[model samples]
Target: MVSAVPECGGPGDLPAPRIVTDLAHGGRWTSLTAGGREWLWHRDEPRRAGVGPGDPFADAGGLEECVPTVRGTPDHGDAWSRPWRRAGEEESVDCPDFRLTRRVSAGAGRTVVDYRLTAAPGYRFLWAAHALLEVSGRARAVMTGG
Candidate 1:
């Protein structure tokens, strides 16, 4: 499970479409089946401290430093290398100010993701959603929001 179209290839050149629901390697969300039950968390692993190989749609922080000369400007900003713009199931990544969109949909048991962030106003930024769900043996998680 690995749908590829993110761009600026590197992770083994990309494109591995078996097609159930796959988008691992940088824009990770590996698999999801819904009510029938097939939610196995993915891992090919390597790339530690900076985080796993499976990057469940990672986004570090935003608007970090760099305005003095402003060349590439990436310490932990710009949504991890930035190259996503697939329309249909929806996948977007842009950065002049901010525009990160991810949309995944499923039914039955539920696998719905609609993460969006569109900033470009006064530009005070701080975004966080580094998803890594690998629960096998003992699993218990309950999180609300603020």
Candidate 2:
């Protein structure tokens, strides 16, 4: 569920900004536009091992290792390949150990995203929001915190 509001701009700009989601691929947001500019980064094809282009759940963030092997979850967990259900401006999926939902809304100058996750009681897990934004030419990322 992704949405965007277009701002006044010059020619070639879209009448409205919009977001495109890929429900089959971890419900990843493949596209985002504001003021006629794309904000999210994506590749035409996969460029690295263990991840594909536009994968929102690229690493699974250790959830696969935490869960029992009997479940047989993949290295990146189930979200990456699971098909989600859509109802209006929301998309959701239920996995073997948890359920996740995502909603997007548009405002005057920004888009807001909400993610919800529910897991069984006592199910210890680690998760990460693996979203990436594209910038012009080259970019760098700094990580802080343990």
Candidate 3:
């Protein structure tokens, strides 16, 4: 499914976020209402081949790289699972194309990571790989799907 990037936020050496470029891609996860949740952060550019623009939101069962979910192991094909929580900086793991950086804030109890839809050129669009929080049965998920 091929598409073009709108002229409004055309693709280029895309502008970087004020404090960090991570937000321009996805964003930081603040609070988790549940053990699982999902979100989509719009990109200023266009989507890539694997992930098309205005694409639907994906959970644990969606495409491997299209979303971010905790797994028991680091395997790409593994299912989502609970991750161990520690402190301080973390070691780096290699990914095929995507570049991910996870930084846990000891002061704020929040995490920030940089996410990209596709590791191709001239491609940018809304990235749903942002921080996702699952809510309990009684809670509700609400967002203006604009």
Candidate 4:
């Protein structure tokens, strides 16, 4: 059975960007892919010590101020950052958390966005990469792991 994919998006701060931290996959970033190239949390590198699977991302950070942004460099940004650009005059959100505010540009035919997720009082969740790629169909045809 095919799931009802939300086409117009849900209740979120539209025209804005944010970090998407899901402890569901043990704090591992989930994904949203299209045209072979996809976007998700944690693309190799390293997972923050306490930011691994099952640990509530925001639950680790305190007072609603956790996570980080990755710009200037891949590791420079935080756990997750997704900017909600104007989607052709549409108002909808596909991301989870609505906290990311930084917007970086693309130079290598790829758009790199960085963001974060906070929990309680000093526990910050760390993430590495979530790239938006333009993979060819043939390449995507044999993809296996992340």
Candidate 5:
């Protein structure tokens, strides 16, 4: 089963909100749940051991971060294929030219991830959140605050 926050909460034993991540393997979020419904797509098969620059696509699903050019020489950049250094709620990876960091926080019914990229002046890079969502046929989106 995907790793998640313990179902038991402080003192009351109430079901706690849950989110899952695999930090050693690309530092990607493997699952996200709210209202007892899963919101991310995941592969049913065993995930590969690791990915590397120029390696074939790791279609292992969930949310992955692509960095420093998504469709370039190294394929899906450098971050998604390597391990990250974790400090509290934040994790960071050092690329050849830049450092990418992400902080995740959860509150109420929402989970927030904040990203920061650092590099020398004049350095340029690209980043994207490659999140795959699980949507059922009857699912509908609610939009607010346009």
Candidate 6:
């Protein structure tokens, strides 16, 4: 089910952004709002209850963590289709060969996400932070730093 982390702004801290996470639905980040603007994209239609391996991607329009293989038989790897275990701010999902964990924290007018993958030695995999942003046609992406 979807869980929400309401807006937080401690007395001494900057205003924290608002976030919605769906732990039952692959731990997807369904909504993110900062500075009175929603940065993530949401689907116009309803979403399916549950998604499984080999099932059509819900494409509910949000942020998805694609683990191991993004173009394999399961489409977006095993994480996006399975439930995650949550402990405090951390959420994790287990694949056949590895375990992926993510910790999300927000404060000081910023949101931070940390990911960790544990697997046997020499195991190789690919990961993608599949984030869909709510942007207009004229919006242009700007990147800085290395």
What total of clashing residue pairs does each candidate reach?
0, 0, 10, 24, 0, 0
Tens-digit lDDT string for candidate 6 (53-81): 66767788788888887888678777888
Candidates ranked by TM-score: 6, 5, 2, 3, 1, 4
Native-structure RMSD, model 2: 8.0
- Model 4 — TM-score against the truth? 0.23
How far does residue 20 in candidate 6 sit from its true spot (Å)?
1.5
Q: Once superposed on the true structure, which residue ranges of model 2 sit more than 4 Å away at CA?
A: 1-17, 46-73, 138-146
**CA error at residue 146 for candidate 4, angstroms:** 32
Put down candidate 2 lDDT per residue, 1-146, tens digits, no spaces: 33233343334533344666766545656676765577676665442224542344343221111112213445445565565678877778777778877786655444566877788788765555445676767756679998
RMSD of each: 16.4, 8.0, 16.4, 13.7, 3.9, 2.5
Model 2's number of clashes is 0
lDDT of each: 0.43, 0.55, 0.28, 0.31, 0.73, 0.81
Candidate 3 regions off by >4 Å?
Answer: 1-88, 108-127, 130-136, 141-146
Candidates 3 and 4 compared: the better one by TM-score is 3
Most accurate candidate by lDDT: 6
- Could you give candidate 3's per-residue lDDT for residues 1-146 as a string of tens digits? 11111112113533221111122112222222211233222233233222322333323221123222333123221111112121244312223433343443221222334332334675332223333333356867668976
User: In model 2, how large is the Cα lDDT of residue 88?
Assistant: 76
Once all C-alphas are superposed, what RMSD does model 1 give against the true structure?
16.4
Candidate 5 per-residue C-alpha lDDT over 29-129 given as tens digits, one digit per residue, 9 for 90 to 100: 78877667888998853444556555665878888888887888577777787777777667788878898988766554445668999999998888988
Kindly state the number of residue pairs that clash in model 4. Answer: 24
TM-score of 1: 0.25
- Please give each candidate's TM-score: 0.25, 0.59, 0.26, 0.23, 0.79, 0.85
Ranking by lDDT: 6, 5, 2, 1, 4, 3
User: After TM-score superposition, what is the CA distance of residue 145 in candidate 2 from its true location, in Å?
Assistant: 16
Which whole-number lDDT from 0 to 100 does residue 102 have in model 6? 84
